[model samples]
Target: MKRLTAAAGSNLPVGPYSQAVISGNLVFTAGQIPVIPGQHIQPETFEQQVRQTLRNLETVLQAAGSDFDHVVKVNGYLTDPAQLEPYNRVYAEMLGHAPPARTTVCVSLWGVALEIECIAEVIDHRLRV
Candidate 1:
């Protein structure tokens, strides 16, 4: 198993935890919030926050040798049920047509509107012969 930090363009973890972990062919990412990388400031609008959070998730996935197409599962947390429609719109736009299995629920968050975490299969090109 290997632990990873946020990639170059992603925000550092706020607490004592790895941004992602690799085990064999799979990579699991920690929940990502909308705080700007290196700036620690979150975007004001919900859509902006969702996009930022997805960017952070993508950074971590790339660092783990994976991408959205390789993701197998996703867990999302939203502060309110009313945000679901907008969240789905942004999610569909970013994740493309064939998204992974997902579970999203209303929950309380610190200061952000939503958080996302995912599990993905790693693509180790070096192993190809």
Candidate 2:
């Protein structure tokens, strides 16, 4: 097992935890919030927050040798049920078609609209040649 820190300029973990972990062929990412790396401000809109969160997730995934196409599971948390529609739209737009199995629920978050985490299969780029 290997632990990863902030990847591809993604935000550093707020607590004592790695951003992602790799074991064998799989990469497990910690939940990502909408805060931009090196910036404390978060996007004001739910849709914008969702997009930023996915961008952070993508950064960690790519660093772990994976991408959205390789994701197999996702767990999402939203502070409001009303944000679901916009969240879905942004999710589809960012994660692409045929998204992985996911579970999203309304929950209380500290000054954030949503959070997302994913499990993905790691790709060995050398094999592509």
Candidate 3:
């Protein structure tokens, strides 16, 4: 079992613990705020936050040698339940047809409007690509 962390762009150990962890061919990402590269964690709109949150997820997934298609499940935590529709729409657009199984919950985000975490199975890249 190996605990995952930001591999390239290292940041302070924020909040409770590490950013991500991987074990037994599965990678688990900690809750990621919409802290895009060169951008603040705080964003102006729900749409922006949602995009950034997904981007952040993609970033970590890339670190794990996985992509959105490799994600088997996802959990979205939104500061506002009303943002569900827009979130779903955008998420669908982002991942195209092979959308991973997902669930969205309304919760109070610590410092942002949206946060998301996910579990992905690392696929054999050579076999596929």
Candidate 4:
């Protein structure tokens, strides 16, 4: 059975989609932008936007019983090509040593600077040997 999840303390999805969906052991998250819930303070730089976007992704992952360490793939989209370098820096720091396989590209994203999405393994820690 498939399960849909919406992080309790995160921004509600502006569209019709749920924040994430879980099918069996996999959790697939919708694209996460830099809109922090209840906070109107927008990021002033690409790096800050990257941080907020990743945090949003984290919320979805946690709600799905996963985390960055369990992520298997990532797809990132930037509004400008120049944002890639700074984005990577923050991404590396957030994901640490076992970063997931990723593909990033520049695209027109309306007013947002960037977005990130991922697929993760939904591991139940207590069941692990």
TM-scores for all candidates: the values are 0.93, 0.93, 0.85, 0.91
**Best model number under lDDT:** 1
User: Model 3 over residues 1-129: C-alpha lDDT tens digits?
Assistant: 666556454233466676667766777888777766654445677788778778777877777667788898999888777898889888888775798888889887667778788998866443222
Model 2 worst lDDT window (10 residues): 120-129
What is each predicted model's overall lDDT from 0 to 1? 0.89, 0.88, 0.74, 0.84
Across 35-112, the per-residue lDDT of candidate 2 in tens digits comes to 988888898877888999999899999888899999999999999888999998999897758789999999999888
> Which is better, 1 or 4, measured by TM-score?
1
After superposition, the stretches of candidate 2 with alpha carbons farther than 4 Å from their true spots are 125-129
Ranked by lDDT, the better of candidates 1 and 3 is 1
Clashing pairs in 1: none
Q: Candidate 1 or 3, higher TM-score? A: 1
Compose the digit string of candidate 1's lDDT tens values, residues 66-87: 8998999999999999999989
Superposed on all Cα atoms, model 4 deviates from the true structure by an RMSD in Å of 2.7
Worst 10 residues of 1 by lDDT: 120-129
- Could you give the C-alpha RMSD of every candidate to the true structure, in order shown? 2.2, 2.6, 3.3, 2.7
Residues 1-129, candidate 4: write the lDDT tens digits. Answer: 355546887888887888888877888899999987778555887788889989989988887788999999999999888887888899999986897899999899878989899999988643222
Clashing pairs in 2: none
